[model samples]
Target: MDRSKQLYEQDATDWQRGMYEDIKTTFRAPIVNWYFRSLTANEPAFTRYLWGQLKPLFQTRAFGRYAVSYRDTVLSAIEDGPADLPRYRRADTALRPAEWRELRGQLATFDVVAPRLALTFAVCDRAMHGDLPDANPEGAPSTAPLPPWLDRDRGQSVTMLEAGDVPGDLSETVDEIRAFHGLEEGLPSIYRCLAQWPGYLEPAWTDLEPILESEAFERGCRDADAVVDGHLEELPYTPRLSPNDLAEQGFDDETIDDIQHYVRAFNRGAVSKVLQTIVTYAATLDAGGERSL
Candidate 1:
C-alpha cells in the first residue's frame, strides 16, 4: 500500500508537470482562447447550445478512443488506488473491496472523457481568436483518408450529415442516438423531452435519395457502409441489436431513469474537473510570466 501511494504521488506530480508544460506551449496560443470563448460563450445557456451543435460530430470511433484512453489512465491509478493513504489514514477505514472497485470504475469512465474535454477547451480557445479551421469546402472530393485516430464509420456519418444529404430531421435523430450511446455530454433538455423521435432504422428508403445524389455524400455512405459491413462480417457471429431492443431488455422504469440521471451528473462532474485542471495549469504558466500567444 505504501508503495502504491508513492507511485500515485509520482504519477500525479508528472501529470501536473505535463499539464504545466502544455499550458506554456500548445495552450498559450491566441487561437485557443478564441476557441474557448466560442464554445463556452461566457453563459451557461450558450454552453448548452454549443454542445447541441457539436454533439453530432462525435461518433462511435471517437467515443471508443475516449473510452480506451480514459480506461488506461484510470486502471493505472487503481493499481495505485490505495495511495490516497495520507488522507485515508486521517479518515474512516471502512472501505470495502466492492466499493473500491465501483469507485475505480467511475474514475476510469471519467478519465475516458477528460482529454476530450481538454480538446474542446482548446477548440474554444481557437474560436475566440478567430482561428476556427475552415469549413470543409462543398463538393470537395470525399476520398481523402481520415486520421488514424478517427473511427472510420463515425467519420463517414459526420461527412454525410455535413453535406446536407440526410434530411435535417433524420440527421438530428442520428445525433440523438449518438448522445444516448455516451459519446459526449451536454445534450439539450429539449431534445431529451421530445417523445417518439424517429429511430435510425425508420428512415425511408426514398429519403436516402438526397444522400446518394451528392458525390461526396455517396462516398461517405460507401465508407460508412464498409465499416458497418466489416463489423457485421467479423468473428463469432452475433446479431446487431437496435437501441429499442437494448432498452427493452429488463430494466424497470425507475432504474432506467436513475441511470439517465447518473449519466448526466457524471458528465457535469467530469466537465467541472477538466475545466478546473485546465485553469490551474494555465494559471501556473501565467505565474511563470510566459507569453502564450
Candidate 2:
C-alpha cells in the first residue's frame, strides 16, 4: 500500500462516509470497494469526477438490463463445477430465507457485472488517453428491491477479521484466500463474513481454489468482459476533468491523472476478483443457508 494512498478502511475521511453510503445503495453491495476507497483516500474530489460519469450510466434502466442479462450468461457460461456448488453450500445455517436471498442477490450483482466493470474501467482509461467512451448506454430493468441484509441495523457485514483475529483453525483459510486470489491487499471483506461460520469457511476454502484456477472460469470471465465491450461504444473521455478544473478545486493535474489511472486499473479487474470470491461464498447461501454459527 502506498503511503500517499489510504488503502485501508480505517483511513477514511468524513466525506467518504456519505459517499460510501450512497455508493453502497447504488451498487447494492455490503461495503464500498477498496478501489474507490483508495481513490478517495488520496483525493476526495476524485470520487465526484470518477463516479459522477459512471453513476449516471450505471443508474440507467438500460444498463441494469444488460447487467442482468450478462450475469445470467456468465453464470452458465463457466465450466467450473456446478456439481461442486451443492457440496460447498451444504454446510451452512446462519441466514434465514430473506437473509439468504439478500446475500445471494448482492453476491450475484457483483458476479454478473464483473466483466462490464472491467470494460467500464478500460473505457475510462481510454478517455484519459484521449479516447472517449460512449456516453450512450441503453436498456431498462424494472426497479428491483435491494437486499435488506445490507441494512446497517438488521444485517451488516461482519467486520473483516484479520488472520490473527480469527480462531487458530480458521487462520489458514484466510491465508489461502489471500495466497490463492493473489490479491495485493489481502482478503476482500466478504471472506470475513464466512469466518462467522467455521464449518462453512472450512469447506469453502477447499472449493474455491480449484474453481477459480480452472480454465472454464477464466474463459467465462473473459467472455463476459467481451460481451460488455460489444454492448458498449467507446467514446472520448477527457479525465472527466481538466488541469484547470482540478486546479480550481485545489488539486493538480498530475495527482488527478495519477488517481484516475490507478483507480481505473483497480476497477478494471476488480469485478472478477470480487466475483470469484463472492460466488464461492454464495454457494452455501444458494444451497439454503442451513447451519448455525
Computed on alpha carbons, the lDDT of every model, listed in order, comes to: 0.29, 0.53
Candidate 1, 1-293: lDDT as tens digits: 01111111123244333432342232222111212222222222333334433333333233333323332332233223332111121013233554433332322222222334444443333333333344332221122222343311110000011223444555565464334334463322112211112231223212332332334433432333233223222212121111232245543455334333332343333332332222211121121111111
Tens-digit lDDT string for candidate 2 (1-293): 24245545555557667677666666654556656666676666766676776664555444454554455444554435454443433326455665544555554444433434554565556555554544542322223332333212323333446644677787777777777666666555567555655665676667656766666667666666665665455222223544455466677677866755674555464535665345344444552221111
Winning model by TM-score: 2
Q: Give the poorly placed runs of model 2, Cα more than 4 Å off.
A: 1-17, 79-84, 87-123, 136-158, 234-251, 268-271, 287-293
TM-score of each: 0.26, 0.69
C-alpha positional error of residue 66 in candidate 1 after TM-score superposition, expressed in Å: 6.5
TM-score quality measure for candidate 2: 0.69
lDDT of 1: 0.29
Supply candidate 1's per-residue lDDT for 236. Answer: 22
Q: After superposition, how far is residue 113 of candidate 2 from its true place, in Å?
A: 8.0
**Backbone clash count, each prediction separately:** 19, 12
